[model samples]
Target chain A: MTDLVKESSTQILAREMALTEQSVERRRRIVGLEPDDLARIAGIREVVLAQVDHFASVFFDYLSGIEEGRVLTNNRALTERARELKRSHLIAMVGGDYGRAYAEQRLELAVLYGRVGLELRVFIAAFHRLLRSIGEAVMKSTPQAPLEAFASFMALKKIAFFDIGVIVDAVVFERERVIRQQQDAIRELSTPVLQVRARLLLLPIIGVIDTHRARLITDSLLKAIRANRAKVVVMDVTGVATIDSKVANHLMQTVTAAKLMGASVIVTGLSAEVAQSLVALGIDLTTLNTIGDLQGGMDEAERALGYRVVSMDPRRDGAPLSPG
Target chain B: MPVPVLKQGSVLIASIQAALSDRDLVELRDDLADRVGRHRSRGVVIDVTALDVLDSFATRTIRSIAYTAKLRGAETVVVGIQPEVAFAMVQLGLSLDGIETALDLEEGMALLQAREAERVG
Candidate 1:
């Protein structure tokens, strides 16, 4: 079933999910940054690196003290458990190359933060606390020129905010990617097209026919029809829970597209609910060929294929000597 | 340029080999109808695989041409619509609804033959 139209299913999946996988190069291009500013931020790497542990301790101490942060951490010892990870994130913001490479790493961090139940307010407050710690640490560590340290801290601030923006976008993109992948899997499972006979295909739709799955069903069925030169396609909807006017329209379009390719469609498993909805919506699916169940649809397909089943001796189970 | 329509036995085969101007499509429509009448063709297969874009004008022409051929007793089957074009067409609601279609020329001819057999038998 899968091997028949392998390439097309993947092609459609990629196209539908393409909008979710945001490109780091594209993001970098949009948010242009000068090398000097990056260098200044990079300079904080060593300074932060020395006091990173202290910075993490201070930040998490402040976070775990807050009511929202306590709820986020579930009252766990966040300072003891997550300090190392937080320290590394701070170091990455200060030292790591703010390019495509770090953007990917930032995505991982985003996913982790999202899973850990970090809310936006808490997240912003945590960043603010880190900035305060950096100011205090810089004042204590720097000598001679406080103004130069201030400039470096300002650069660090810009980089921090920029990294935060990237991380937020990455979180949204990752969530979307995961959702699209799940949709792909569900679509694949629900709209399984089987080669029932020599030139006959069967698609049993067993769930909600959202527009995504509907498009996938159409693409897959058409591809199978073209590849196998199928004479008939049976779309069984016994498993479909329910559908709206839009989904009904999708079915019409699917039938039309398959017919356009010279394949006769037999949509089976039309429960009373779907029929009622079609009637209520006034969606004219009269042009589409349909049957009651899988067996009936297959029988009709066999008839269309000019196959006549008759009881015969097991010795030759159905081979005629000649066409005549 | 006017699209060429060729007679292949009882079936007529024509492929839109280039992007047709409005005049060309109109000419093709009239020419196909005339040939369907003259040859007493049983089937007409219009292939659009080579066409990059199938605009509303072209879609309407094809639909009207199919109707005209059907009026002259020739069943029309459009063939070789690219997958993307089919998807876009369905979305645009220019479904060309009720017209017979095939994946390629071979299937188109087979469908025509099957219908012819059904009609006779």
Candidate 2:
């Protein structure tokens, strides 16, 4: 789930957006951000530029009014930074250079917004208030040409829609990145090849086994066998809820691979339900050296490793202890 | 490079110190079979701790070497297949079945000795 270190954040963003110069142009076309629309927005740039501070204050005020939005705007320092970001973003919107760099900058801003726990809908709702104030500013500035002021607002809305699309995508991408990292963490934690004793390894598999996790389990088990010089492995699958053909095949492959590396694997904790399913599924269990449970598997492993567990208390066993 | 084969008592130890080409592997196999007969060795241990990748050709060659040694009355054990290499082998559907294997050279020696004792008993 972790990408290679060589990939830059910009490159990751590009991949996430599936973006190219042509695709960026395509997005502009889809959002109706044509050259005429850009011209109109640029025509009213001075009017909107003068009212940017007003727009930022209006947007921040709307954000501060909501419960979720207050989580971000409540911090004075964060609100100040967000105000600066808002001014620059608004200035760039009327600047009318809707290219790759513009998309990249907007996405970076959206990432910041995401990091501050700002939901897209909250930002969108607050953004509508700022746009409405800007619309009023346009109408008042162009008092003589009422129709042209309305046209400018329509042109501005198209670019705003384009920016919103980019922000929405960036937020989704950030969430996906978080999910991928969490999955990597879970996969690492799920398959633990623990060395239970000298020359003995215990692999307790829990939960469902997907192909990726199964690969990880086998990889770690083999590495532990080599690292610990383990002679026997007791794999307990009590927490594994099902035994499909694919899972059974993965288990068999793991056992065979361990055998090839001089470590014998004793599978344990095949629940009766799963066992019956395996039988019904016609999975050949002969290749698997299975025991009933973890205890039996450990006993068999101890015997294979030439280890005898002698009871220290004399009263616990009927047999007499041998003199050392 | 040609792998060096050392004889310890009736056992031959061949440690592969570098990535071997196909020619080097075949030569090592021939050298081991010859040395086993010349030294009258009863067991052979091929140490592959240095090899990082064991492709299908290498795996097949190793299996072939074990079978050839077995036919000549010397049991062969492959030792020190690295963890990553073993994982790759499994992913590539390569295996060394019917050939004895051990984690390291010492373990390989123990395995060969145990088999020898079993035969004697």
Candidate 3:
């Protein structure tokens, strides 16, 4: 039984070493890492390293040549190198103490490559795979160590990538969406609405309104007012924390646009700071219905729609209307 | 005297902490041009929040900074001109044509950082 155990362990070691060599070779070819350079760094047998390096270079060249005259282009080569580093690290992690040292060394190398602005996505993917393999190997060897560290590292990397990717994609998507929406709104302005409707168009604006967004809002409101043929349009600014001259000018533009479409514009939701800003800017909203809040704006909107506010009378068990 | 500058990442930022006088404006333009010439920086953001009054001279100086900085291979951003100041400048028919304006110092810094990232990435 002891002899059998020794044989199994030896087999595992040999397999892991072979896998590592294969990965290193594959990666070297992709990244243009010379075989001699890798051999010098790894300090392994020259003949073995040379064989691995030659195979890697030939394989990559063949792969590239077969597909589009070069399977591994510059971009693909970087990705492949990152992948190989990760695989080699994973294989090394299976050898207990020796594997741990190998894994650490590989991580250091990956970090160094990161400084050169290499493919971060590829590196991250490789890091994830390495962590997973390490966790699995540790669980099989010393289950008591708890895979918490490895798990957390992998999770954090995943989340960081996901968060950054989402933020970047969101910013790009939102900018494009706003541009498209603005174009649509501007196009709508050119085409007049056939008839008037009873609904009021409410545009609640918040945050610092930049010139670009301000222009878009003005175009959109004007288009909506014309399209809806609404009698009242409420421009709620309650959520707007502050206003500058540009924002105030944009509001004034909206009011003017609404008036041109034969619609009364109601400006509401002014914070103290914004109100002060507007007053300081000396922007005139004399022609526009300036409400303090959404409720007031809503009431005004309802009134414009010919709905009168009636007080509930207990005696009548229903409601009573004041004399008009 | 050496210009007071803050380095955030690869971006070099200068804060113009006082109202712009003719002398101050001249000094600022020279200082900024000199800094850009020396650093070969990714970008430069000038925070002008403390400048209450932006006369035509100041406005011209700001535009010149943008032009000169661009010539020196650095993007220049002018930030934190108050609403009242903006209104005053507009009323005076001042042009902020070439210079980029941010709402505050933080936003200005963020803009410069983004510009640097765009350049490097």
Candidate 4:
């Protein structure tokens, strides 16, 4: 009867070991966890498989948060919340007799989480929570010196996350600032010049001369020439291409507006296609300067000013316009 | 499936190696959009040199392609616009305003190379 009882107990132990092995294998496949290796690292008896399973589940939540892009905003409030959670988990884990083994598993998980695309903000938050939890657990269960050092190491890990988060936030802010500055510059360039020189102002058309930009160009040219008290203004079209009827009409309107302002206007860079298009549309450009190109228009300006283009070192002396 | 034409280059050079019908055009648009987004090429040169005529739809598609490229932080240049087709485009009152066009494949290559050089230097 005593032998029979011994045989039954041995059979029960064998069945339990098989079940534990199966559970570990299943967790490895599902969560990408290597439990046997982690159990060894934790230095807890391999027989205690339940604790490893529990820790793996907790680490998986931290991983999910990182992938979602939410925890990455690097806000101070969010980091504090994450710290609180890690402290609670560590406290619970350290209270158990298997403290060393569990702490090792947590440390390994923390490193892996860092290597993942987890944003520094979220990682810091998770690390702080982890440190707090481990500290509480260690103090409750073990009075050992090594456990205290382990707790200090975890706290150090939290500081590293904080430093990384600051760097990431700074980089993100600077990039946004530069982008805003560029946008502002473009806006300033696009703003129409209300006035030029005392008698005439030049409105050089740049970029794709769409119907909208063409209208803005015409309106601004008219306003500037009038406001500046100029006798003549040049409408340079060197940058313009593929002028349609709408654009040609806008040009005519500029001529009429400048005349109203008591200033004459010059239309330059009449590409062959644009000239043909104007002709096809039956629009007349006979009253305008209608120069062949920008250089010719500049020469006309120089002639009107009684000045000629001469090479001069701008730094030594301002760009000099010699009398024509 | 639209057969992807492979060109010899250190980086993968895949071209739309088939006649573009309406469906083909839509697929090409999506494929190029994906490529531009994923690879972030310096510039994507769409060689329409084989195509002599560009209908309104084709022009519209090219404009869309250019816009998608811009969103992906890459420039799009349409190459091989025959003079006759350009004339027709002007007559049709279609706008190619926001797009850059090259006279031939060589010009396209030169323009892209110059742009890349400017970026590096």
Best by TM-score: 2
**Model 1 lDDT at residue A132:** 92
lDDT per residue as tens, model 1, A151-267: 778777766766677666655665677787876676667566899788888888876677888889899888888788787888887887776778778888888777766788898
The C-alpha stretches of model 3 lying farther than 4 A from their native spots are A1-324, B1-3
Docking class of 4: incorrect
* Interface DockQ of each model: 0.43, 0.49, 0.02, 0.02
Query: What TM-score does chain A reach in every model?
Result: 0.51, 0.64, 0.37, 0.35
Whole-model lDDT for model 1 versus the true structure? 0.75
TM-score of chain B of each: 0.96, 0.97, 0.88, 0.83
Give per-residue CA lDDT, model 4, range A78-138, as digits (tens).
4343344344444433233222233222332232233333555565565455445434443
DockQ of candidate 4 compared with the true complex: 0.02
Cα-based TM-score, every candidate: 0.55, 0.59, 0.30, 0.31
Candidates' lDDT values, in order? Answer: 0.75, 0.86, 0.55, 0.52
- Each prediction's Cα RMSD? 12.1, 8.4, 24.4, 24.8
lDDT by residue (B1-121, candidate 3, tens digit) is 3346876655678887665568867887888788776766768887776777878887787788889889888887776665445545654667665466555566567667777777789
The residue pairs in collision within model 1 are A260-B101
User: Per-residue lDDT tens digits of candidate 2, residues A251-283?
Assistant: 877887888788988999999999999989888
lDDT of 2 by residue, B1-121 (tens): 9999888999999999999999998998888878878888899999999999898888988998888888889999999988778777877889998899998999999999999999999
Best by lDDT: 2
- Chain A TM-score for candidate 4 is 0.35
Ordered by TM-score, highest first, the candidates read 2, 1, 4, 3
Instruction: Tell how far residue A226 is off in model 3, in angstroms.
Output: 32
